[model samples]
Target: MLKKAIGGSLAAMLLAGMVLGTDALSYVTTACGNVREAVKSEITPEFELDRIRNEIDKLMPEIRQHMTVVAEQSVDVKDLQREIAKKDTKLASQRDAILALRADLSSSKDSFTYRHVSYSRGEVEADLANRFESFRNGEEALARDRQILAAQKQTLRANQKKLDSMLGRKQELAVHVSQLEARLKTIQASEAVNAIEVDDTKLSRVEGMIKDLNHALDVRESILETEGNVLGRIPVEEDSVDLHADVVSEVDQHFGLTADENVAEAAQSDSL
Candidate 1:
């Protein structure tokens, strides 16, 4: 509105200046006669004024349209603000109602406890003690498994070494048997064949020993793998206790930490 007023004032001043200037020029020209006609021929004041008025006329409709839209928008904005204020008031009232309901629900809930489960001081203490006992048992079991794992690992190493020794001996025996067979092949004379006539008992025994060694190693390895599974996820010192500790920590973190507080609360409730 202020901008429009200023622009209108400027246009009015321009129009006024044009009119007054043309009249003054006309009066001067009338007094000067032919000199004024020459000036008039140069200026064409009427034509300039007519052109300015035509341009102003073209702009006026657009200005009026802009003003009309602005007025409508202002009314719409005021209505929107009123609507928003009403909604805000409604929300405030609803918030208060919700607060009141929550208080009532809390009071009712406190009284509702009389209808169901109650705990004694002894029971609550016993319950937590059981959890503690279970936790301790889990730790002890984990440690014992670790010890057993270490012992069995040592036993496995010993068995593996013994099995290797048996395998080495069997290999030596096999090579000796191959040499004997080659030597017999070299002998062409019947007397030489007769001299070399011997059973492969030692070779059979060595092969048997090799087979037994392999079987024993396989069994030992299987036992170790099974024991590893039982010991749980690798590195018994860390992983074995992780699950138990996590569970206990979660319970401790969530429940009130001080056992004394629980016992006291139970005692107070029991007295009531």
Candidate 2:
């Protein structure tokens, strides 16, 4: 009975040890799986960080090259702007110079003067004096035309008086014709007719004189009508004045230099 009890207790102790061993084996297996999962999760993040670092390292040279190109383009743009500014300044200056020349030409054209009349009659120290005398002579001639016109009017008046006399004589001749008709009715004698013929010859001579006087009066009236128009018939010295003005204009156009206000203002605006 003691040996059987000892064997039963040994069997119980062996079963307990077998159960503890199984429990320990399951715990070790579960802990090992948890440790493996943790290690996998930790190593995954490290691998991702290393991949990103390598990619960045590979792209560094290309990024630096692109940045360098950008820097160089910026410098080129600055230089181009400076050159454009310089060209614009030079063009403005040239335009201002051209404007100044135009202004000077305008000023010179305004300033020029030309002499209209000049005279030197045999070097009598009378350039202006001779011209003045010529002007005076023209005035004198105009005055003379007035005087001659007055004289011609007087002659016209005299001719008109003679025409009046001729008109009276014509009326008298009509009266004599009526008287002869009456005499023809009253008396018819050859000797009396010869006496009438002599009287007729005298009347005919008076009629001829009247015709001449009327013609003379007409000529005198025509002379008086033409006297006022004589001034219009005088010639003008157009070539001299035109030549002088053209010469002065050409000289001013070629050699003058004067600036305008608008050009100066433009230059100032460009500088600003």
lDDT (Cα) of model 2: 0.59
- Models 1 onward score TM values of 0.26, 0.24
- lDDT tens digits, residue span 1-272, model 2: 99999999888667756877767556657878999999878775336545645654565575556556555655655565565556556555655544544444444242322266333332223333454455456555555655655565565556556555655655665566556555655564654676664577888999999999999999998897678468575434333358786875686577562346546766999999
TM-score of 1: 0.26
lDDT of 2 at 38: 93
Cα error, residue 103 of model 2, in Å, equals 0.7
Query: Distance from true position, residue 159, model 2, in Å?
Result: 99
Model 1: weakest 10-residue lDDT segment is 106-115
Clashing pairs in 1: none
Q: Write model 1 residue lDDT over 1-272, tens digit each, in one string.
A: 99999999888667766878757556545667978678878875445555645654565575556556555655655565565556556555655544544444444243312138664544444544565565456556555655655565565556556555655655665566556555545653565767785569988999999999999999999998889888884755443457887886687679856767767877999999
Worst 10 residues of 2 by lDDT: 118-127
